[model samples]
Target: MKQRAQGSAGAGTPPGDARVPAQPRPADAPDGFRERDTAVPAARAARGEHTHSERPIPEPRPAVQRSSVRGQILDALRTALVTGELKPGEVYSGPVLGDRFGVSATPVREAMQQLALEGAVEVVPNRGFRVVERGARELAELAEVRALIEVPVMLRLARTVPGERWTELRPLAEETVRAAGTGCPATYAESDRAFHRALLALSGNEQLVGIAADLHRRSQWPPVRRGRAYLVADAAEHMALLDALISGDVDGVRGLVSQHFAGAG
Candidate 1:
């Protein structure tokens, strides 16, 4: 009976001698909840601020970094031509390009030769290479190749793609439309590339993918000059293609896809 009374008294009291005690609490309060977020910005400014004399970005890289500056020279010159900063039918010599890229003539020579091999420029004996001018002929040929390679693959996708696969592409389509509306050319260009790439990805054939990427790169010359793009048609065509895909309209997908390429001219 005495033991029973002792047990009841122990249960009624807290484990510690004191009946009242502090409750356990979380280790730390959430960041920025109670304290001002002053430490971050002030610490960052002390370490380094975006003030002048922070050192200019150094000149855009000179040649000889990798691919031995020579390859760099070639890529730079190609960029100039493709972007229309360089005019067609204009000849450039090894010496001139070397000066432009701040490299020696040897690298410039190397680059020009490579460009000539790729048919990106014309190299003549005893004279320098001319940037090859793009024409409708190339565009039409590219379109023809795309039609041969991609249309059938898309038809296969139209038939083979499950509804779940089709639904996954909705976000890419919306991103394309949003990018186009923003008037950001580069953003739109990427979103534009993404839509076609998503469709071609469905083909699951590596060789077809390589061919499609090459054609798309070559086709950029025409639209880039026009300041608009294959993007508008691409977005519209992708939308139509999606509809046909969901509806199981293989024939309609092929025709609409072919029409999209037809405008490549």
Candidate 2:
């Protein structure tokens, strides 16, 4: 006839033929070739029960987010200390601050521990943490120590760092002036330290920059009870010092540095 539909018997059954039954795959089949358990969902559906795939996925836990929240709390606490919102010597409980910040007490407690390490606050046993009450004498002493460390290094840098380099730092000095205008002691203190730190960095001494920064931070804790006028004046002094350094006026730099620290005390 027509060659008996050529090789049909050798190919077993043709596509969609009902004569052949399916065979199970070999156990050594690769994982990618394995079949999924499609019957489970079908069996559950036949029993009028929900399928496993229909179950909701769980939301991830928030443990990873705690560190970032703790850091924000620490910064806020430091700002409160600098702005006098957290009065010196006053004890503040973690739960109270947590309620105010819209978070749990754990992050607040962790932040307070960091502040304690920075000497901005002290632990008060079961009470919580107390803002460290730095007095005039201690503030003066901190300022004096800062002056001793920064002044000589600045003088040396003034003699060597190029005019263009000092000019480039003008923006930082201007930032201090802008910060002072905010009337927030914390803002001004941060900008003030930034300018000083940048100037000290030109000395190429990482250790000196670190030590001076530490002293500067301690001095700003419960920042001096000076008026906005004092802040503006201090900011202007930064610009004046920059001017002296740019013009290579060693004596002028020395005088400005001395006067700056003197008022700080």
Candidate 3:
């Protein structure tokens, strides 16, 4: 045993105890680390995904939100529309909807008009527009029409689009599943609509995009277990489409999409 460092020894008797001094950390050692050895590849691997050579520092992403009163109103109305809270061919009065929102008729009227324009509601003679009533036949027609106009385009675009681009839609697809499982008709409906919209959006046809929106509006029905069924199948369908697209097999993608519409009928 060696003598300890001199300090408050006047008050103590022990002088033979050796001072256990901490070794100084190397300059390259980050906090919580002891040392860095550049001589071995394993040491470099232990540091991180990159060596002392090169690495990518990811840029921070900006927060996204639904902003603007009109946008918010549209969102709320879309929720109502999808939830089947608004029935087909049923009229929603400006004042009634306004009261439901605890707001004035101005916003409700605006929302109603927008929905009507989207074909979610139809104008009646000497009366307000009814949320467009879709019969089984109408739904079948819509499913078929969409498969016709959108499927080929989706197939083509899917090939050109990278897996990463498709990945951006994965969250929306997952949300559709959650919405269906939880029986959240409103959320389920919006996310369901988004799933298709995202697929069509891959084509970059704004006019065709408008047609898709109209079809969705015309496709609405009362909340039913079938809606959930449709959502689940459609979610899986989206993944299948992506898979075929990634593989660069357009014909296979088209056939699957066509089969889906056949099932829709």
RMSD of each: 18.0, 11.4, 16.2
State the displacement of the C-alpha of residue 250, model 1, in Å, after optimal TM-score superposition: 2.6
Q: Rank the candidates by lDDT, best first.
A: 2, 1, 3
Candidate lDDT values, in order: 0.70, 0.88, 0.68
**For each candidate, what TM-score against the reference?**
0.57, 0.75, 0.63
The TM-score between candidate 1 and the true structure equals: 0.57
Q: Which candidate achieves the best TM-score against the true structure?
A: 2
> Which tens-of-lDDT digit does each residue in 71-146 have in candidate 2?
9998899889888999998999999999999999999999999989889999999999999998999999998999
The clash numbers for all candidates, in the given order, read: 1, 0, 1
Question: Residue 235's C-alpha lDDT in candidate 3?
Answer: 61
The lowest-lDDT stretch of 10 consecutive residues in candidate 2 is 14-23
Q: 181, model 2: CA deviation in Å?
A: 1.9
* Residue runs of model 3 more than 4 Å from their true location after superposition: 1-70, 124-127, 162-164, 221-227
lDDT top scorer = 2
